[model samples]
Target: MTNMTFSEQIWYGLFKPSKYKELVESRKSRSVLYILVILLVLGLVTFVVPTAAIITGFGGMNKLFSETMAPVAYDGNQLTIEEPFRMNVADTVFILDSTYYTVPDKELERDGTYIAVGSKNVRMTTIIGGEKWMDNITPIEQVLAPGFSNDSLVDMVPAIYVSLFLCYLIMCLLYFVKYGFLALILSFIINSMNKQMEIGLSFGQVYMVCFYGMSLGMLLTNFNIAMGLISPMLVSTVTVFVSMNFITMAMVSMRKGNQV
Candidate 1:
């Protein structure tokens, strides 16, 4: 810690957690730096990586939408699709008119996303992702000639970007809260062990170690996922146990036989 810079300590904490005691002793600023670096790493792994994958997988969603989804004529009162078509749910848009009707697209019912045009109240259902959103649409001020407009599909990019960003931000905060809570519990255990060993380390020091220790657990969980060795349902539980174990190992390595 005396010789290493703040950025160096961050790398050390991730790869060499045994140096945590020395790192924690130098300056409280190290704690803040470590936290910011950890969060940045987590954000890159969880958000940035997935976002890149999605962008690559879609291969220009706007272009795809423009080429595919187009408005088709339907009864003003109702639009029904009984067959699967290339222009399925994502491409289908029901234009609102004087007639209030029901849409029953068998293809959409099986798997698709349908949009009700000219109304703020719209039902968006995705069969594959198993997500449903209902809202009164208020954006379209005029009724078009009762057909799908590729421009409408292309125009949705900004809203989708905003929604995705908000969701990512919320998820990051939730993860921080969850990880911090678990780290605090692990810190309590380390504090008790410190007392037993006659070590004088404070709870703050142990808590910082717990947070840094979490990086190892997060990395391991990511590795296990990439290797397809663990199920998504078990990741949180496994992460907690793994992170706690890392903290325990750090405590033992950093202080042995009353050496703090």
Candidate 2:
């Protein structure tokens, strides 16, 4: 229509070739305006929720849920208590029947460091068990980290979450720069085909897609499926992909005032 062949007029789009074909064949709106708006919004959605933010949010959510749905029971005065117990996240907890290694010198050093003269029933928890750790592990088989076994599991979650948060953020930043909007658009279309989203969205509509999209791809793969259970990053990435394309294409078609 613009003095160019159909193929020539159609070169590259945010959508992949397959997605572009589907988008072209379908009745939709296509608008090229608001590139900045799309970028800003999608950037926020995908980037704003850092892994730390996510963990914090999850912690807050856990707090709220615990407070709201805690068990109710009778108190000493026959009164009702909504919660029977309080939950706290800890890294590691050790309840050894007895000390395997004897404590020397009643005067404890300013630092908490204690010398391990010999083996003892010292229940310990570590973050990551390594080769050296295995040698002195109480459970032997339960050697968490040779050099990094968590002394307490309860105390480690937040720290672990923090480390994960940092990695998660780094990956997000790296991918955001590497992929940017185009990658987001293409990813959006693919996820749409997978039915990850009911409708497509625009990069502007769901900010932070670039950061989160890559974050998820890397995080989930590392975690296998444990993180996947409650990972919104993956879900957002998928929704961002499928929904954005439909949304962008729809917007474009609307601008043209014509049917594909």
Model 2: per-residue lDDT, tens digit, 88-187?
2221121212122322233222222222211222232222322123223243223333332122334465675575455445544544455465555655
Candidate 1: give its CA RMSD in angstroms: 6.9
Model 2 has an lDDT value of 0.36
Candidate number achieving the greatest TM-score relative to the actual structure: 1
RMSD (Å) of each candidate, 1 decimal: 6.9, 16.8
Clashes per candidate, residues 3 or more apart or on different chains? 10, 61
Clashing pairs in 1: 71-147, 71-148, 119-137, 120-136, 120-137, 120-138, 121-135, 121-136, 121-137, 122-135
Which tens-of-lDDT digit does each residue in 121-143 have in candidate 1?
Answer: 23344344544444333333233
Give the Cα-based TM-score of candidate 2 against the true structure: 0.23
In candidate 2, stretches whose alpha carbon ends up further than 4 angstroms from where it belongs are 1-158, 174-181, 184-248, 257-260
Q: Compute the lDDT of residue 241 as modeled in candidate 2.
A: 59
What is the C-alpha local distance difference test score of each model?
0.59, 0.36
